[model samples]
Target chain A: MKRWIPFILTLALLVPIGAEAAIVVVVNNANPTEKMSERELIDMYMGRNLYFANGQLALRLDHSPKSSVRRDFYRQLVGKTVAQVNAYWARLLFTGTAAPPHVIPDKSEVIEAVKKNVNAIGYIDEADLVEDLKVVGRID
Target chain B: MFSSIHTPLRWLICGSCLVLMAWFISPGLVNAQVINDNDFKVSGFLTLGATRGGDEFLGFRRFVSQEGVFEDEWSYKTDSVIGVQFDKKFTSNWAATVQLVGRERIKNSFKESIDWAFLKYRINPNLTARAGRIGMSIYMLSDYRNVGFAYLWARPPTDFYSLIAFDYYDGADIVFNAPLGSGTFKAKFLVGSSENKFRFNDSAAEFKLNNMFGASLLWENQTWRFRYGFLSFDFDDSINQVLGTDLVADAFELADAFGWDGADNTADDIRAEGESALYHALGFVYEKLPWTIQGEISYLDTDYDVIKSNITRYISVGYIFDEITVYGMLGKGSQTSSRTKLPDLPDSLSSIPLAVQLRDGAQLLYNASYADQESIAAGARWDLRYDIALKMQLDHIRVEENGTVYWASDTLPDKDRAINIVSINLNYIF
Candidate 1:
């Protein structure tokens, strides 16, 4: 009875909040490269691996700070918390080491940042990719 | 010998002109995109911390002297520190930075200070040059000794960092960075000399101090980095010369009191002298995936006229999870010098046959040696919130040396052999 009650409650809670779901991923409309493996994509976004599949410098873009999309992006791609990422950068920056990639504020901001730069790539909700923005691949 | 005066006035004037040029050229000239938006501004950071040695002697050793004296009770104060760094980015190609640090009295009562300044001129996207006061890059973690956030713990291994206190020199560095297929490459070449005053020990008739000149090369690629450097210093005649004379006179007095055959003569002939130091250091770091490890080995060869050489090595390892990291470290070493005397002989017996002298002293006089000290530290870092972390560390240290004890009845109390320290800190960076 208790399990049934919790299951019913969960359904009740989720049914009304049928929020939009988005498959976020990066894409290149003009480049010859067609697809990226999950590892390659995660490497590019997490600031760990910087080179593209073709060995070219991969310029990356991001959702704005504190954005839900950004949080989801990292949770799905980096598998680490914001605090861990901050600590990672702390270790890197203070050691006279490398700095992380530049951060753009929002989906629109990222879309604009990536659109203007040829080597750029970033994530946004699947629904957000209109006719202008191309969909290279879906995450998961 | 320290009073070498140069054209300080000329340097100051040149600095003023550079500032004026920066102000006059609003940067719309080079990139045209950069403006005096005041949005582009400079920020700085500073920190101050102090510690009191425990009732039992605590803290850094008296390095100037080779002798170890345990203080019954001593309250120590250090500038601990206050510093300011001004960071300016004029264009995508030009950036300038200035750092000034004030240290507490290094000498008995005189303060010490160093001005660390740099002007970085970016050549292309992968290379740059920096000129000004630059500290040597010993370890990847050694360069930013002041920027506390670099490490997960309160401090990096103190044994290595503390041994060669001054790591920076005034010079120019050329740094290059490039990306390999899956990793990044970083290289730095630096050369410079130090213009500063440092104090080592408080006792000893043969104290040593010197001015240092050196160069270091560092290379880092993704998960691994290596550093190798050589440094040489010219030491001036020591303040111990007078102390050595006094010891000789005292020896003569003691020999007469002891009714020794050479009652009229003293062992002043055995007074050991001081010498300069030339040293080399090699360090390595590997951080791939969830594990990070760092190790450094250094060899310090003092021209102490006599005795065997001294070499020290330090190693540490760390592992990181989402927000927590645990680390362990081990450091053990010793310094050997003929000047070190055995402690057992009467204060008057300044010299004797080497074999007899070795037995008479309780690791005192020319047995002038530091206990082979060893320590094992384990610590964890917890990130409680954004920008702040709570850290707790425990360290157990062991010191091997000859010390004294008062006979209470017939029982022997274990003198100073083991020490335990626990520290908790909240660190934050903005």
Candidate 2:
């Protein structure tokens, strides 16, 4: 029973860590690209560069502004908080310079959108990722 | 009575049309998914603000009882404005955009003014050509100067931006965007002419700029950006009869009496006609997470003797803490006006009646040139909500020489003065 207690405590600690490790960036299975650098992701998401590595027009999708996943994704990918990202977008939008990514309601919709559109790219929890989507990048 | 009613009715119809269009487009926009592939998109920003000063500053009157007079008190119309924009994509490579802005200026009520109306043709992904009424890209923030939400300050430092008040020109431009190393490089060339009607000292004047041309280059990386721009324009203030009216006529009449060969031509030469100017600006911005620094310097050289050459610069630094940001800015402007020495009025002409008046007129012209001023500002911005921000700022301004920059009344003291201004604003975007 003493040995079992140690193993159970370790398992409990690893569960949340494992869950956090599941955050990843995903693209359509048909995209043909296997991976993306962090800089490329930042450019597309921030409306700086609109073309993907393959010269294909890129479409960006986001989790809802209120989502914890969205906040975590931006923090990991761009080192900006959700509020900072929102403020940045406000500058672009009000200037008629660029538009932000279309926000989806949940991780499921993000997955569905990316799966159906070859140009679409999104971020989701690895646990929610399916075989139909290609994992292009992973949040460290 | 009919004429007054007619004008208001026309404005009402225009206002209603804009509201209806916004209503129809807001839903599709709010439902982000519904407008992902739509043909039309609508967006806008609004800023409501109140400001007060310990002394008269920046032409903001403390009360409506006087015009162009400096007063010390609170005012609401200084920084409040609203803007709306609509974009429509007709084809893969064709698009059109229209933007309207309303603000309290020389008028009492909000008057809808077209800020930009342009048609765009995308020759390729990297290049675009646009024609119509386009925002002048002379300065770093010129394109979005009125959009308070886009900037960190309740207002851009007026010391430098107020040098040229025209924001748009009727003409065409071409923009090129290309990838350079890990960064992006953008170049824009514009050619346009602008006409402006402005009120100075309760007197209105019309200014027409001809053959205006400008070019700008910007290179931006993940953490840093550098920009350089140049502009040249031919200025004509011939229609501004108010300029030197009381003195110019007397000077010319005196010249004719003295049998000066170019008596009539002298007024034209000194009247700011066919005057030309060259402007150059260099600016940079560095942003890395919680730290931001931005600075710009500009130089203007003009042939108009009454309008002295000037140099202006400002630097701003800020730190972002979660949803709050605190910043400080320092700015300075200097003008070099060469005092007209009256060309050593001949001893024989010293006895003449009009000769003395002409010399006095020239002195007034030199005095009307811009003054040397310095400003320091500290401000904080808080993101109150996803689309709303609250900002409060305090500024201390000192005029070193002539204090003509703030459009003070003739009755106000023209010598050096110091003023403090406190402003608060709510900026929102949708």
Candidate 3:
């Protein structure tokens, strides 16, 4: 598992949220961020950066804990398994070091979560992407 | 490994502090988490472990506070534990966290389980400060050592991690984190007084650490993290079980005072108070897919004779294969400095019972504090499910002459022994 952590951190090499889930990272249209890199995406999702590229606070959102899309989203964005990511957060969370992103459920809820807050950023299936949500990055 | 404020009234005081901090942050630490989710959250982890083997009389120990490892018997006390955490994020910039762990750490009380209770205030995106009781962050894993599912080992290497039995400090610290190129750079500074523990059955054996100051720096990028930590404190311990309650220090002082034949007037060299010690460590972790490597080397330098100056180091390499991970580790700890000198008494004078005791006690104090030992281990971890893991390990250690102090035994061994320990553990998080 020690060795497994390295492959998980090489975020640039892999982008499959799952082997087949084509996902698109989305933010409220009100959010000025029009593009996102995996690095920037990882920074926000991993609690390293809480503000959007435009210097506005970002209310990061995620799928429910058990949601497969949520699992793949982290794998695609950071090359880490959901368990590894959870352990990482456990260290920070239990230590009062950082706050994890707010969690909403799967599907339209993930999209609705982004729409309700201008500072929100979330991921949804590319097919589920709606006009109300601005696509920042797409994971194949 | 933890000490909590005793008395029901104390909880009210702790609660009052909590309320005050919460009230203090409300007047617009506006960065409060702007989320709709419930602000209070709870989480926990558990580990069920048992170990068998090793010297029956010499007993294995993970912490100095532990009476002994289940010892040559399959006992769950060595690693079995459960910890629960509660967190309330008041705002984006303010929060409170408390963690309680249940284990066999002799305080045998609920208070001893309180490992962390602190108020966190984020000064900015790149800086944060915390107050109250917090874990001793002097080592790479000290922050989360109790969470078994977070790491790959059955337990931290004893030779290195167990050298200093301190658990947490009551004080404050400021942490700074910022992006450095493609990675992150973190710096921390802390100051506070730590705990003072009494042996389970012995009151004279008190361990007190005061006026502690510490700092650490870490640089991490994809696949690798490097860290260095430094801490110092004034230590005064009268552990009768090991060093005979300052007998060696007093013996030397008297011999030098009376100018014993071999005494070079160096009695004042070791004192009962004002003794200070410094600790420093360098550690690194690297991971790249199927393989990971981690290593750390730490040194404890002190003028005190009981602990003397000591150094410990370990390196672990692991490989993952599907749901299972296999790993091996090498570790060693040694006494680096000696603070005792034998008296040069004539054979005829040494025959006196008092003189014989002085020489033997001095010899015992000089050699008994040594933790010189080396160990090698192989282990396998199976993560058959998302939140659970099963681990099995076999450890072989060879103890050096007079190095039995690391064990739980009070009497020094007549001869060094080689021992083996077999362990199995089940771990989970929720």
Candidate 4:
């Protein structure tokens, strides 16, 4: 009961009430990588580990500021808010410990970038999928 | 001879030239972190803050190395700072990065402002090596301590972070990461030499750490992270340098005057030359959704008697409510009872000026480590935008007499007192 208080208050106190999309992780079709696991995606996205199962370097694409899909994606993936994710990256970024992922505000731009690079990994709303990309995993 | 490292104007010219070269090499430029299609990038962070309230004796200093001390006033000198970094990747396996920070520094020069300039060589997907002046990561937030946007609080808890300060070590390190169970295991071994220049009122002191060896181990999963670290270093010079007076000479002159010469824990134990010290720390963080909790405990062991051994620890808990985070923290720093004791001068000679000199000086030495204090803080952060945030914090600190380690005092009292401090910060990144 004590642990549930914060969770209950969060739902009751949150200010933004918008429709959430089912966020999906996608890769270039040219990539031979099979379905990625949650652990692998987390590692890649967070720069904890930069290699895929195929032993190839992985590049990640991120959503721009205030994107609803980005918020739901991090909350569903790591149980953290977008601000928390940014703070985590800031720890690594300013220190030159790791480089942040490239950001694309438009879904079309992300799709095109993914199609051009076999090492690229990105995510989007399942409803906005272009079908040319491979759906490796879902945030849920 | 060691003064050569203080040259900053030459470093500034070189830094400017290099930045210009990077700019021209990348004819096309995008936003921060992305410079055209080329592998060169630039990024920066800044914070302008207002801090007020504290005892006049307690100088508002963030760390020991900084020269500017906020003396119980509404001063911006203590919190306003800006930093810029340039990163150039030559190839898949080779890279170089340079970072420069501008703020109220020890010397207010480029040498003191340049935090990190290192060359990285990726050995494989799991292993990497870095040379040149590398950023030291003894604590969890040491890497990003300057980037206020990277943290939820207006500042890191003071009791723990302010205990000791060295920006980075001038040396090399190897970092390795591997999959261990459901989490990632990371390890680093580093060796280097570092220096800190501190100013207290009208006096200045220099502390140099030579022949330093350290190791850090970390393991983290989705919701839990743990870290253990160890560092050993030798003082480059007698810690009497901290007193800024010929304390060794004073100790010996008094020893000769008194008959208890060569006695244990007495004047004989005042040899503080080049003592080696060891530091160990353990920390952990648990974050899931709207809840976050983290804590760290560190111990410093030194054989030097006057400079007593020390320990510091803190724990913080925060709850996230969408764009705003409200957090509370508790932190403490104190001297351990593990030091050679100096018996009070015999009552017969207590009134003598020489005996008084030795006793008062020894007491001051002991009080230097006593900047002892226990503090509790509550703060709130509002993320106004993706790149900007506003934060305010209030700290109530109970100061113990003789702990000059954190405060500035002309004469330290043997009493304990309470003081409150408030800070407001606007943090941003680009």
Candidate 5:
């Protein structure tokens, strides 16, 4: 009976935890460029090099705190964790130097923010991409 | 041939073949269900630069490092550094981070080491507690000053941050956030002691593990923000007793030369006395259509036995125009002690007392002291690119003793001024 109970709980928990989702980079449709290399995307997102292909300052949008897509994107591209990002941002904020990218609650909000400004760029789950926002890059 | 001829040989050959096969195939098999959710990340930055300035009394003009060691005037070096941070999240409410910095300060120490290492547990939406090497809440820029790309200037106002250089403590802190009608307010409480030892002259200097407490409240909206903070530090005397004695002796020798046996030595007697300091700072930043300005003011008080109270204040203003930022600062402070009291001393062959000595070489010369200082600086930043910025700054300092200027040198180009500094820095982040 004890073994059976453990097996039942494992079955209930494993199903949802194993699911995988798509990762997509979203930029304003008005932005001239439709594609970006992984390196370019990294440079842009990390605040290393900010000029877009059209030569305008790229204002980045980020996911709200602890969002799954935010975690996935930074882990894959920037190679940092959420806590590290927080620490990094703290250093920036207190130093009166750089500020973090703007953040929105979810993919829909990101799309809205990006659609309004040509300089805006963000990422969302592949399933969440809206038509008005262009997908500039994809992470497999 | 041996395997075919003997059982032992056959077993050995079979084992060797199995090991070789496993080595090539095991890795692929092990990779089947590693289950990486892409929830870990790594990022970092590097800052490398050299500085030169005029009238560097004690080499105070360059970045804070050992080699500068209080040298005077023209110097160059790159003790600037690079650091990397790693962060991971195991669950929604739990996260961890480790930061490693490499700098020339600690014998080229590679371990900039654990600026913040802690496990954060969030009870609900508005509260969290973290225990580990927690950052101090004392000064606004203390936690982040090491990262240059985060700020427009090559460095923070040294006059303020340098006085209290210790910014991190090994301990735990709690934070609470509340919504206050169209704005949010946050409060943080930290209690801990520094585990590291700071040594001077080949021995550990005094740094008491006294209570360190601070409270700050910040309110922000789309275009405006205001913050106020108070920090109270309790510590035992950190000055070396031998050094204290030397200072006292110097004062007494000056007094004796003037034959002022009636003058007060209260200042000299206070040497080696335990002292404490309280620091308070306030700042307000405003951003609106086409303009952004920030102003900060700070006041600090240090109470020591022999020295008069030290009061210091710094005020700064900045304006943002597109990608260009222009700023300036005015700082002033003073340290003074009462001259009313005199230490009695025998004069000539008589035990009789005479007029209280006020001369520099008089016996009571130690009781009379003065330190009045003021600094003015102006600078600007131009963002040539998003991640790259160019900044230039010029600063002038004036020192006054009892309403009369002192210590001014010709190279400084101004009396009562020891140094005039011109600095330029290029800042970038990766």
Candidate 6:
């Protein structure tokens, strides 16, 4: 029984960490753009850039604020916690200078939204990726 | 008698109506439209704050006084505010926005004021233009000054912000954004005019600035941002009437006795007229995970002698821990007048009794420009919920030379003194 304690504790901690590693940024399979650098991603997400490299108006998607995947994605992409990003967006949103991305309920909805729109971009767990969505970038 | 209570109560009723309207529409509106795909979006923010201080601060009467004595009390009308914003996108290239904000003020009733009403047209992927009432970009946070939840401080430093009496201008602006190196560079050019009413004591004065123009440049990356701004305007204060004051009459009487042009000595002469004033500001922000640092320096100079030239600067540093952020700020400011002694009086009339009174009054006016202040503040912000934050702050301010910058009752002394203020606020957004 004592030997089982360590195994259970290790599994409990590693499970969440392993789950977090599966997050990836996804785009429509038809998007001519193959990949994007971290700088471009940050600029697009922060509202500094409104268009993709190909000059198409970019439509960014965000998961629900309560989702753990949404929190992890921002932390990995911009080194900002969920609260910090929210505060940052609040400033821009209230000023009419910029607007945050449209929020969908879960990873599957995000995938569906991205699949339907060529200019759309979203992030989801690696396990949620389907055939219609292309993995443009992976969150480390 | 009815003015004070009526304004606040009316504001409360208006606020209730807005709350009810938003509550009734949110569920249906949100479900039917995705934010990015929708043609219309509605959003709002509110901040409820209470401030207490050892002495009168920031034009707010902090205490009651009898005749020439002051007593300590709490003032709650200093920083409470509510605002709502609406945006409607007509097409991919065109959009319209309006924001209304309500707050307590000494002169205007608590009616919601239109902070911004503008139409935006996207010229290209890299260029855009907005026309209507837009906020002046003189300071780093000027775009979001009233959005308390966006910043780490409970309030911006009063000494610096109080210098500018106007916030919005009726004009147009164009913004250009480009990728520079590994960062983004943005340039904005704006031209417009503004008219504002400012209150001192119980009297309000109207100030107009015409042909107002400014430009701002910003460079930012993931961890750092740098901003520089310059603005110049043709100022006109000709219609400023000093209500409930006899100073103007006294000055005229003294001027007549000297057989000199009293017009030059009258209060009207002090009006800014078509004079020009220039303002320049530089600011930077650096943030990396748990640590953040930001600072700004600004200077203002006017062609008129009566208006004092001033310089102000502040630096703030903070550390973030999960949902809580703690910050400290240090600031200093000074104002100096150009005219040391009123245009040298004629030697022939120097001996007149009126000459002495005139000289004293002029001296009083010159002395009023003397201000040297320093302040230190510490504050903490706690994210209480998804969209709500609670903040508390304490400030220690020292008036090193004169207290002309701050609002104080007649009974309060104007000499060097230190004041302590405590403030708490709840900020939220929807």
Of 3 and 6, the candidate ranking higher by DockQ: 6
DockQ values per model: 0.17, 0.38, 0.17, 0.30, 0.06, 0.48
lDDT of 4 by residue, B1-430 (tens): 5356433334434445554665566332223232233367777677887888656565666766553344457866566667778888888789898888766655666677778999999999889999888777777776677789998777777788876677788999999989899889999999999886776544556778999999999998889989998889998764555664356555655565675444334444455666899988889999886888999998989876666678889999999898998999999988787333456766677778876776666656656655478999999999888888999999888887666577655556557768788899998776
- State the lDDT of candidate 6 residue by residue for A6-74, as single tens digits: 999999999987776767788888888788888878888889886777888788888877789988888
**Ranking of predictions according to lDDT:** 4, 3, 6, 2, 5, 1
TM-score (all chains, Cα) for each model: 0.63, 0.86, 0.85, 0.87, 0.59, 0.88
Task: For residues A23-139, write the lDDT of model 2, one tens digit per residue.
Answer: 788888889889988877878888877778877767778887777888888888777777777767876665455678877777787887887788888898777778898988888
Q: Candidate 2: what's its TM-score on chain B?
A: 0.85
Worst 10 residues of 2 chain B by lDDT: B61-70
Candidate 5 total steric clashes: 18
Q: Judge candidate 2 against the unseen true structure and give its global Cα lDDT, from 0 to 1.
A: 0.72
Question: For model 1, how does the per-residue alpha-carbon lDDT over B40-60 read when each residue is reduced to its tens digit?
Answer: 322222222222221143343
TM-score of 1: 0.63
Residue ranges of candidate 4 with Cα displaced over 4 Å: A1-21, B1-38, B67-72, B250-254, B257-265, B338-355
What docking class should model 5 receive? incorrect
The regions of model 3 sitting more than 4 angstroms off are A1-21, A54-57, A64-67, A103-105, B1-38, B196-204, B237-248, B251-259, B262-270, B338-345
Positional deviation of residue A136's Cα in model 4 after best superposition, in angstroms: 1.9
The residue ranges of model 1 lying beyond 4 angstroms of the native Cα positions read: A1-85, A91-108, A112-140, B1-55, B58-84, B101-115, B180-182, B196-226, B232-278, B286-290, B305-309, B336-339, B342-371, B402-416
Q: Candidate 2 on B275-317: residue-level lDDT in tens?
A: 7998888888887779878888889988676666888889989
- Model 3: per-residue lDDT, tens digit, B1-430? 1135433234334434444554454321112234543267666677788887657557787766666653547777777767767787787678888987766564555667788899989898888999998988988886678778878889888889866677788999999999988878999999998873534332324466778999999887657889999999886444333335455556756665554754433334433457789999999988666777899999998876656788999999999775688999999988886435565676666666786677776666566557888999999988867678899999998988677656776666778778898989998776
Q: Alpha carbon lDDT of residue B21, candidate 2?
A: 74
Worst 10 residues of 3 chain B by lDDT: B25-34
Best by TM-score: 6
